[model samples]
Target: MKTDLNQLEPQALVDAFLKYPPAGFQVHEPDNFLAFFYTRFNLLTTLDVALHQKIKALPGYRHWQNMLHLQTCFVGTTVTEYTLLSAQLSAQQMTEFLKQHIQKTRLTIIKDLPLNSPFISEMENNYSQELIKSAEKNGFLSVEGQALAYVPIDFENREDYLSRLSKSRRKNLKRKLKSLNEIDVEILATGHAKFQDAEFTAQLYRLYLNVYHQSEIHFDLLSPAFFQAILQDGDSGGTVLFYWVGTALAGFNLCYEYRGNLVDKYIGFNYPLATDHNLYFISWFVNLEYARVRGMKFYIAGWTDPEVKAQLGAEFTFTRHLVWIRSPVLRFILTRLRSVFEADHHWHQQQELKS
Candidate 1:
């Protein structure tokens, strides 16, 4: 079980990785935030569990300083080169520790789609060929993208949520819903929705595209396959699908129950229906109101929707990242050195943009 990993090439490393499955490892100033999380091996679960404990116990909750999507999956923390803190274990012991206690043993490596890489046609596919050929390997890969955080109508304190809203926007939404009510309109929350294939996902993807494009703000374009993976995952865990105005495909917002909070991750509205029937704001009723009724601590609307969320009396908080430890101090040093050595090439592009 005690293997010296340094002796292997990427191919061999892939073999040992699937065999032991990393609990934690070193990451340097990551590119694409995580496109290169581990050129070596995955981070382990001990550190991940510790990281989550530290994150939840941080002073943020009282201060309302919560993280959006990247809520410190210590098992998968990305780090700077050569950084060391206090993990207090040899690599061998740490490896044994992770294999023993990880709740979700079927761990996954996440890759943002359309990754800016030519060698890997689909980064997940590339990561897969290396991983699947070795282990349980049925390719149960689940991918979820971070949504722009929404400003929720209810915060830790109801007053904080209300005080943040503008009077005009609040009044307009209320009036809009009331007006709909008079016309015999009904809004319903569809239970635990799923999109089994690319077509359904494509429809949702198109709706997501329209909402993002309508804002004229830059956002990632998710493929239909991406949404299908999420829906498949949702069936195991409870998912929220809502229907509005009778025949609208409204949307399925994937929710996760973690650390006593529910995160509403992906969402797609029938944009045409949203426009034709004014169904967009109904999301406010279904997602938020449902969370409140369920006695959940927070209803996470993904990022960038803060502007619209503010209308619902949602408060905003900035997330912070802290580095505590890195192992094989020499590994940290060499990685940092590589990044610095590579920086000059990367810096020129920024310099040219300014010039």
Candidate 2:
């Protein structure tokens, strides 16, 4: 639940990652990051419901799904991440460490590296590439994962920004904003006295759960404790913008500033009212305005929903994971089945059409 990994002790983060191990998986701490070894069935990639169902109907599908993976405890949004001691590891050191750890743990598959710009630079893209290439030489397979969406905030005002959008989008957004003319919206930070209230924390957690449950692709279910930890952490730099309909809460956006970029992390809303008021579109503009007013260089909207994000004038940045399977038989099987784990080129094509 701890939001600021910088503030928490390294051991605490390790303990948190180990809190809930998936069935048939045991936690392994190789240096600073936690990896999980799956003793039974596991998914190597995300699949659409129809394909997943079809695969489930196939014989030996359970065995096909089984593999080891890197631990990803907090995946609400894909903010580039690294090992706890990543700051201290050089590219060569990291490569050697990973090689040694994989050998020691006897892990066949390593999924979701989730390297951000900083981690990528620290590890050096060339070194990371060589590591994957070396793994491939030894029969490992690497594949592209999800792409993250981000907006660079450069306009002087909301209208100035609106002018850059397509005429239809500009008109539609203005119409959406007009519907929320009377709603009360207040942005509060962790340093604010009102944010200390336990009731607000509880309400925020409830809203988060609502959004999580409604989501089509559910990966990580964040705990209330995580929200509370981030809210209470003096160094986390977390903030929230509350949308109110008179005395009742309609919606809220939880975000933070990381190195001059406004990271729009999570959102929760009271469904019917949120839909009625067009809170999603309203929040998008409001967050952009907030970032612009604060003079932030970029606004990271997070991963998924590429079509909508592209429509909003955000740019895409793709991420990838390097996977290595130990068994020759399984490795051969995966090589033949690699297309299943590759990035959704069809989805990318659909997004390109929208653009």
The clash number for model 1 is 17
Global CA lDDT of candidate 2, please? 0.62
The digit string of per-residue lDDT tens for model 2 on 1-355 reads: 2223221122322344455443344545444543343443335436555676777788886675544233322211222232232335444554455556554333344444443443234444444455556655554577666656778887888888888899999988888899578688898876576658889889888887788778756555556665666566555566789999888888999787766778777799888888899988888888998888888888878765666777787776554565655556766776687666644445676667876
Error of 1 at 129 (Å): 37
TM-score to true structure, per model: 0.44, 0.76
Residue 288: error of model 1 in Å? 1.6
**Least lDDT summed over 10 consecutive residues: which range in candidate 2?**
1-10
Q: Which candidate is the best by lDDT?
A: 2
Itemize residue pairs with steric clashes in candidate 2. 1-226
Report the Cα lDDT for residue 111, model 2. Answer: 40
